[model samples]
Target: MSQEATFKSIVCEIFGIQEGDVADTKTPEDIESWTSVTHMQLVARFEESFKFQFDVEEITEMDSIASMKNVLRKHGVDL
Candidate 1:
């Protein structure tokens, strides 16, 4: 799979949602399982999925899938 597809898969698996249903606008407020603890889990998922760790600011800026992709790219991740 492409990096984008893998990223979506990780998000879908972490949030218990369908990959097809994911969008750039989706956020914590839009998902029932996206609680504080789950947010940490999602962060960890991203780190593990991409094999890179995010700093505090980067973690906080991961508000949506679009932002996440942007952050990942900023960190030199191709996705």
Candidate 2:
């Protein structure tokens, strides 16, 4: 699958939501399941699936799907 598709899948799974419910603008404030623990779980899952490690700064900056995409782009990921 494409990176965007994979990303949505992971987020949906972690948040226990449907694919249609995910959007780049969504943040922890929008999703009840997006707690601090699930946030790290997302980091771990993204690191594993994308094969890149996120530094502390990047981790802190990833409060939304758009931010995560930005950090992935910085790491040379296309989407």
Candidate 3:
């Protein structure tokens, strides 16, 4: 799958949401499963899947799916 699809799948699985529910606009404030602990878990999962670690700024700015994609891309993840 493409990086975008992989990202979406991972987010959906981590958030316990459906594929159709995953969107760029989705944020922690908008999703019930996106708690602090779960957010960290998601971050870890993303790092594992993409084989890269997010720095403090990247992690803090990843408040939404779109933001996460941007950060990943900035780190050389093709998406």
Whose TM-score is higher: candidate 1's or candidate 3's? Answer: 3
lDDT of 2 by residue, 25-69 (tens): 988998999999999899999899999999999999999888988
Model 1: how far residue 66 lies from native, Å = 1.3
Query: What is the alpha-carbon lDDT of model 3 when measured against the actual structure?
Result: 0.89
- How well does candidate 3 score on lDDT at residue 22? 83
Ten residues in a row with the worst lDDT in model 2?
Answer: 70-79
Q: In terms of lDDT, which candidate is stronger, 1 or 3?
A: 3
- Native-referenced Cα lDDT, model 1: 0.84
Tens-digit lDDT track for model 3 on 8-67?
888888899998888889888889999999999989998998898899988999998899
Instruction: Return the clash pairs for model 1, or none.
Output: none
What RMSD does each model have against the real structure? 1.3, 1.0, 1.1
- What's model 2's overall lDDT? 0.90
Q: After superposition, how far is residue 54 of candidate 1 from its true place, in Å?
A: 0.4
Q: What is the per-residue lDDT of model 1 for residues 1-79, given as tens digits with 9 covering 90 to 100?
A: 7888888887888789997768888888888888888889988887887888899999899887789789999877777
